[model samples]
Target: MILFQLSHAAEPIQVDDGYTVSKRFEKYRKLDTTISLPKLSFTEGQLVEFDLRYAQVGQRELHLDLFHAVPNKPSKGLIIFIHGGGWRAGNKSHFYPLANLLAQQGYNVALPEYRLSIAALYPAAVDDIEQATQWLLNHSSELGISTSPLIIGGGSSGGHLATLIGFKNNKQAHLLTDKPIPLYNAVINLDGLLDVTSELALKFENRKGNDSALAKWLGGRYETIPDLWHQVSPVNYINEDAPELLIISSGQARFTAGKDKTKRLFNENGRTITIIEHENIIHTFWLFEPYLTNLAADIAEFLMDVSKIEQE
Candidate 1:
């Protein structure tokens, strides 16, 4: 078992308590007796590079852990999986097990740590994630990988960021650099919100009044910054050029706001979005066994299909 910890040259910024696999597993196990936590160990014949610094914002250094097959020939493609903590809490380690599993499947997987809500807010997280992807692409040759058919994905808030990054495709000006943002060939959204401004999102996200995690991350309530809410939504950026999408929902309708609308827009442009719904499961099912193994298989299949289509 290889354990990787977040490494920082300078003292790291103290953030709020973020989500962890053990805690989440405990919470969800009671709900689903069939679920088990996946062991966070290195997969056989896979290589892991930990704490590779990607970007720096002031005193904060953003880093990512990479997992890839040992004799990584015939690599499928790069998969950047972001971690979810409602944008306030959650570290890159949350997805280490998933990354290891994907690497075992002949995919190079990256787990990046972005500035959470408590550290920055709003576009900071987005920008950090974009920079992470850009860094990976810039260093791809050195890292011994071909980044074609790049795939971006995440669970919960990470999923939302991935969707937004994939759909936006660097059309908008980046907050951190003049370098063009990398485009993704496929997006795997693991139960992330499609539109934060949707009625269902507003109700669920703001159920705690003004103290909701969404509000904290966005810097205000939807009523106060309606335009910003719309601006950050992945649904608003859909176009014919958007990457192929694969959405896996944990039987949670509230988190999937604007899914139908986004699908409708895609259909209008003669595109289709794939969705797999898991009934009677917790929101973070991707972190648990059976579900995690199943998700890795689904993602690998989807990426392979997308890559095949892209090649043709």
Candidate 2:
């Protein structure tokens, strides 16, 4: 491991040597575990909290948790980071640690909570994400950040949702508001759910259990509702105009199911895409290890580079 000095050091990452990979949670291993790689550049930083309502549905008022780092300099861009919960369980609060890390790197972070499967179904989560993005776009000024090139990011199922809302064709799914479609400058997907067709869904089922998450989130098994699976998949929505996308993954579960397919789709569509793989880790490793320090730095660098490229 490369040693970084105090001036260049990041907050110590959360490490777990005893993170046993059980048969039940083994599929979770397939997502991006953020294994150690080339040392990343670091920056010291602080977070400023902004708790504000970004949207409303029915009687439920939706609020976004925006965390901005005390900029040592000017801001790079705005990133809306979503939390992963299998679409059944997870809160926007889950990303608080990561939000601060990104903020330190000079990107304002927006962590938004979308409707979960327990409360709403399929496109509902997608609709909520659309509203969240729209809210960010509409309130960029009030939030005190740059509006151009809003970046969308997420982990696990949240990664899936980020991709769905960022790149998928607007006419295919429901939208939260009738305003113009939210266009993203870039997208960062960390082991997101990419495919829900019967083949991949059944594979996940056979690996984990018969109670596959894809079925629960979509309201039916892929075998029963093939069209819905196809419609909600981010891979199905790629085009030349799709945002420059960065997909992070591990060699396990989600990556095993979606990597090749994802690479092929993005390549065929002529989209600017970057794919990085980490070894021997479960999904979302930065959430846990000596990994988070550099992961944050790495992501900060990515955000900076992608934003500059898109701007040029």
| Model 1 ranges with Cα > 4 A deviation | 1-12, 40-44, 70-73, 170-178, 307-312
Residue-wise lDDT of candidate 1 within 47-136, one digit each (tens)? 899989999888678889998754645787888998898888888888888888888777889999898888787899988888998899
Q: lDDT score, residue 158, model 1? A: 93
lDDT of 2 by residue, 126-175 (tens): 88877877777777787677756578889878888888787773323344
Poorest lDDT segment (10 consecutive residues) of candidate 2: 12-21
TM-score of model 2 (CA atoms): 0.79
List candidate 2 stretches off by more than 4 Å.
1-47, 169-178, 206-210, 307-312
RMSD of 1: 3.7
TM-score for every candidate vs. truth? 0.92, 0.79
lDDT of 2 at 192: 82
